[model samples]
Target: MRIGLIGAGRIGQVHARSLAADPRVGELAVTDLSPAHASAVAGQVGGRALPTVAELLDSAPDAVVVAAPTDTHAELIIQCCARDVPVFCEKPCVTDQDAAQRLVDQVAASGVPVQVGFQRRFDPGYRRGHQDARSGVLGELRRVHLVTADPAPPPAAYVTVSGGIHRDCQIHDFDVLRWVTGREVVEVFATGANRGADHIGAAGDVDEAAALLTLDDGSIVTMQASRYNGAGYDVRMELAGTEATIAVGLDSQVPLRSVEPAPLGHPERVWSSFLDRFAAAYRAEMAAFLTMVERSDPSPCTVDDARRALLIAEAVAASRRARRPVPVGEPSSSPVGLGSS
Candidate 1:
């Protein structure tokens, strides 16, 4: 299969290597705003670099991977759909709610399978949790707790347009929460504090946040995110149910310590970033996309799935500002100003 990749940035580079290494991928073409960057990645991956998106698409690749900036996702996905090319796009298909809805409708009308990248859905631990929860092995999930913290904050300029922590960081938790539990978030109450970085506060964003989410089945979920987790990058989820309790990201490398007398030993090495933590999952998702293209299967993670997760993030952001619970899908009293990471 021939694959076209847009963008040559960090995530795009990751996808380039993944796609290039795949035995099924006979050809890989990449494009970016920086021709040099595209050429570098293409050289490293044994692929070819194209000068523009038009040329890459015109090359008639079997499928396209939209690993470009978040703001460019909808346009690129629509372009791929117009050519009946299956697309695997990175998350938050569109940050703006109305635009997301329109993109969802457009993609649906195009009859092209579009898979949104929420790589956690491909992680082994999260996949196990999803299977257990849906197969009744977890038995009546009672509560869920999720934590996603970065080792450090992004640049202040990024914060200014990041759509705040809820959309930028914790949206992963939101997407995985729904995927693992097969539940819809009905309401959200969120709060935040600017404890670590003055610039984050200055930009009207928080360095830390927490949210309480109510699921459609009355299960309660608590999520926390921080940009100042000095220890390491930490992402974990615990599901407590009537029959059993399960935890993900509880491996030997987890960046956590117990103060008890008989405590577990310190981690030998901690994950430094999302890329390190989810490398395998990223590869797995890309492989899944290729399989979908090969078999003509429907998208496992559809655009509408991404839209639902974005709605939850918007509700969380609105609740943080309003200091009250916000119903999912409710029109925000004020603009949520959805932005991407």
Candidate 2:
């Protein structure tokens, strides 16, 4: 299979390497706003660099990976679907709910398979949690807790356009929550603080946040996010049920330290970033995308799925602002100030 990769930035480079190493990908074509950067990535991956999206599409790749900026995601996916090419786009396929809904409608009309990147669904631990939830191994799941914390904040400029903490960072937790439990978030009560960098506060965003979510099945969920987890990039989830409890992201490299006298030794290496922590999951998601392309299967993570997650995020953001609970899927009740890409 031939694959066209859009964007040569950090995440784009990661996808390029994965696609290049895949035996099924016979050719890889890459493009970025910077032609030199695109060329650099293409060279590193033993692929060709295209000057523009049009040029790359002209190469007739079997599929396209849209790792471009968030703002470019909807248009790129639309363009690929128009050409009858499958697409695999990174998370929050569109920044806001309206745009996401429109993209969902357009993709449905096009009948083209487009997978949104939610790598946690492909992670081994999360996958097991999902199975346990579905198979009743964890009987009557009553509660869930999730944490996603970065080792450090992005540049101040990024904060201004990151759509705040809930949309930018916690959306992953939101998506995976739905995926694992097969439950929709009915409501959310959230709060945040600017405990770290002043620039984050200046940008009207928080460095740390927490949310209480109520699922449709009456299960409770608690989520925490941070841009200043000095220990490491920690992302974990725990599901408690009537009969059992399961924990994800409890590996040796987890950054948490116990206070007991006979505590486990601190790991020499810790997950410093999303790329480092979810490397295997990222690769696995790409492989799944390729399988979908080869088999003409429906997208496992559709634009609608992304829209649902965005709705939860929108509620979280509104809850933080209103200092009250916000019902999910009720746009009139939750007026949000969505950030730009």
Candidate 3:
């Protein structure tokens, strides 16, 4: 299928590389606000770079991947759906709930397939854990701990306009916890501190935050989010059940020395590269999305799935602001979906 991409940013480049490498996608057409950036990416993939969204739509791509800035997400999705083109949009859908809801409604009314990019759901380790939790191998998941931290801080522009930490970082963990447990988050409480050594709060965003959620089954999930992981991009999760406790850390190559000099050999080490562990999952996710689109099968991650995740994120942010537990409604209470796991 001919696939057009909007945006030439970092994650946009990642999508371009993946699509270019994939066999299912026939052509890659990209557009960026900056002509030079678009030209650079198009050169890498031996594809044409369009100057405008109209020119891109004129190419008649079967699907489009919208990785542009947050504000443009809803509009781009609407435009793609209006043309009956399936869209793969990046997460949070839109920074605003009402607008996001309206766009989601439009997609459903148009009967166009729309998938959101929540890459953690595509992580192999995370998929294994979700399967285990669902198959009773975990024996009733009781608690989950998710840690998402970036290598370092982002620019003031990003911090100011990216819808804060909840939307940018913690939302992934929030969404994944719900998917892994196969339950809805009922309550959310969060707190954060953006102290010295960082100008994060100066841009009206938090550099660090933590959230606690209660699921429908009374299961609990604790999420820690930060944009100040000096080492590298780290995303790890530990799920504890009645029978087994599984821990997966992305950056395991980091050395850990024993305080007491009586450990086996000297110290412990781990593999820390996030991509090394998730590349296969990423490929699988892309393949699955394409396969579903080809066969008209339901996508595992739908537009409503993305919306529900964003709702919980919104609740977490509200909980932090109110310093209390915020209630998160079920799919029935809200116009969202809780698909079969």
Candidate 4:
């Protein structure tokens, strides 16, 4: 299938490489804010760099991959669906819940396939845990704990626009929590601290935050999100239930220390970036996306899936502000076979 990619930055390049490696991809077109950067990425991937997104869309690729930044996602998806081109978009969809809902509605009405990028669901560790929980191997899931901390905070400019920790980082956990538990979140309570950051308050956003959520199935989930850990990228999950417990992304390496070498030693060595940590998952994600394009299958992660997670993130922000439990709105209808854990 022919493919067009937007945004020739880091994540865009990642998608470019993944598409280049996929045997099903027949043609590749690229575009970016900086046309030169677009040319560079296209040259590397042996694609053509269109001067504008409209030009790429006019080229009539079978599908387009939207790897652009967060704020641009909703508009891009709307435009793609208008053109009858399927889309595989990076996460968060958009910062505003209402706007995101509109995009979901637009895509549905247009009957254009849209896959939200929740690649961690494709990661081996998370996939296995999700399967275990779904298959009743974990008996009845009671509690879940997810931790995701980057080595350091991004630039202040990045922080200012990132919609804080909930949307930027913990949203992945929010989606995973729902996907693995097979339940909807009913309430959220969140708190955060901004101490010891290289940039104080970091554009008024917390450097570290934690959230507690109650699920419809009566299970509970705790998410710890931080922008700085002094160590490399840290993302791991633990699930406990009636019969047994399970863990992912953390290792039991012999060397136990607070310096990131125990309970998951050398996670730093294994992953210097979130991109590194989820490389295989991204590849698998792209493959699944191609399958959707090939077979007219429902998207692996629908626009509703993206909006649901965004709603939880907004609820978390609201809870943190109110210093009380905030009720999340309606949970999505049960997803049967979307390959969700």
lDDT of 1 by residue, 160-219 (tens): 776778877998999999999989999999888888878888877788899999999999
**What are the runs in model 4 whose C-alpha is more than 4 Å off?**
198-202, 252-270, 330-341
Q: Can you write out model 4's per-residue Cα lDDT over 119-152, one digit (the tens) per residue?
A: 9989999999999989998888899999998877
- Candidate 4 lands at a TM-score of 0.92
lDDT at position 289, candidate 3: 69
lDDT of 2 at 287: 93
Question: What is the C-alpha local distance difference test score of each model?
Answer: 0.90, 0.90, 0.77, 0.83
Q: Which stretch of 10 consecutive residues in model 1 shows the poorest summed lDDT?
A: 332-341
Question: How do all models score by TM-score?
Answer: 0.97, 0.97, 0.89, 0.92
Winner by TM-score between candidate 4 and candidate 3: 4
The reply for model 2, stretches above 4 Å from the true place, is 261-264, 332-341
Where's the lowest-lDDT run of ten residues in candidate 2? 332-341
For every model shown, the clashing-pair count is 0, 0, 7, 2
Task: Count residue pairs with overlapping backbones in model 4.
Answer: 2
At residue 215, give the lDDT of candidate 4: 91
